[model samples]
Target: MSNTIVANDLRKRYGDVNAVDGVSLTVEAGEFFGILGPNGAGKTTTLEIIEGLRQADAGEISVFGQSPWPRNPALLPRMGVQLQASAFFERLTAREQLRTFGSLYGVPGRKADEMLEVVGLSDKADTQVEKLSGGQAQRLSIACALVHEPELVFLDEPTAALDPQARRNLWDVLRAINTDGRTVVLTTHYMDEAEVLCDRVAIMDHGRILRSGAPAALVRGLEAAARVSVASGVMNADEARTLPGADEVTDDEVSLTISTRDAPKVVAALAERGALEGVQIKGATLEDVFLDLTGREYRA
Candidate 1:
């Protein structure tokens, strides 16, 4: 399949510091791709370069077979963007804000009404931007980004600080966007969000990409062979650490994810120690891979 975006050796500097240093990656067409990193990791800068909102000091970028720099006319209308925090008229209602955004692309205002439904904001259509709650405003921002019906969409931390139910609701909306064949590029520090929403992810750090692949593949590439989790049982993390074939073990109170190359052997050892009651087995997760690669857990 052809790639929709290709960035090479992209660099951006702010005075004495490099914000995006020698970063390169490709995004396939119609795929949900995520840029995962902590704060000041160049995720936003790299994304801004691709979206044509910022200039890169060095390297190259191409989106949809055309250079994004120098303000490519053909690229703008085909793309949508939701920045870290969306700014609106504040006075306008959610529905009116979307309508105003649609007019920028020369599309009829009615399209905003359709987008409102897509984002599950139809109930708050008449509420002003300032009156809308955090979650509602976020959903409105996404709706505004997509009101023009672009082929590619950029969503930066779309669900930040949302309640659990609101975040899940927005995830469904995002899935619908991807299902319609719009290529999506998302930047987030949420491990579970990236694992569930992205088809492939690039783990970035300090202005560079550490690894890039499907989430499952990257986690598999870790030294861990299998992860045996004790869901409902409590095992002392220190005791489990010494179990046979256990290379690493993480105990989070009620659950433990034991990384081992030898699953049966590890299980036998655990059983011998009477630690198998209400336990479970599973594969390693993207979060595990992030910790192994960056030596820092994703916190957002």
Candidate 2:
């Protein structure tokens, strides 16, 4: 598939702060790509530059092989964006909000209603934008972005305000559109969301991308230990630590966890002792890879 977006050595500065530094990435047509990082990371800046909402101080960007800077009208018709902080027409109901946005691209009013159904906002169709709950408003913002059925969609923390069930519902909506061949570019702080939805992900921090690859590939690359847990009273920490393949052990009031390089060996040893009650084993995950690259520290 052809690349829907391409950015190279993209850099942006806000006064003395380097908001985006030497970022480079590509999104293929029909692909679900995610950008992940903590607060103040450059994901949003990088996305804005690519979406033509902002221009980078240095570097090159192309959307559908055309320059995105200077607000290319040609690109605008083919791209849809749902910003982190969404704005709606004053006093507009949910349905009106979508219809207004769809009208911008000559989309029919029926298409607006269809999008409302797709985003699970049909019941809230008559509610004013300001009156919708945070999650409902978020769904409305997403509906506006997809109302025109653009080929490429950009979602900035699309599920940030959603409750768990609403977030999962939106995931289904996004997955459906992507399956229909729409390209989706997402930025999110949720590691599990990125892992489950993205075909590939780029993890960024301090204005630069530290790693980019298929989520599972990145997790495997970490070669981190698997964790096995059971009820705390099943075994003492010292006893758990002595088990074959167990590298470390921790016992809290609720559970006893063993960190091990060999899950099968550790699990077999636990079974031999019949202390396998409530046992759960978890392997390395994308979050582990993320923290390995970006040190644990607070980011504003």
Identify the candidate with maximal TM-score. 2
Candidate 1 clashes: the total is 0
TM-score of 1: 0.89
Off by over 4 Å in 1: 225-259, 268-275, 297-300
For candidate 1, the C-alpha RMSD (Å) to the true structure equals: 3.0
> 1-300 in candidate 2: lDDT tens per residue?
899999999999999999999999999999999999988889999999999999899999999999988999988889889999998988999999999999999998987888898888899999999999888888888888888888999999989967898889888888987998999999999999999999999999989999999999999999999999999898888889889999999888799999999999999999999999899999999999989999888766
TM-score of each: 0.89, 0.96
Error of 2 at 260 (Å): 0.8
Clashes of each: 0, 0
Runs of candidate 2 exceeding 4 Å displacement = none
lDDT of model 2 at position 66:
96
Q: Write the per-residue lDDT of candidate 1 for residues 1-300, one digit (tens) a residue.
A: 789999999999999888999999999999999999878889999999999989999999999999988888999999999999899996899888999999988878777688898888888889889999888888899888898899999999998899999899889999999999999999987899999999999999889999999998888788567878875355778888888899888877677888888999989988887878767777778988887877755545
Backbone clashes in model 2, listed as residue pairs: none
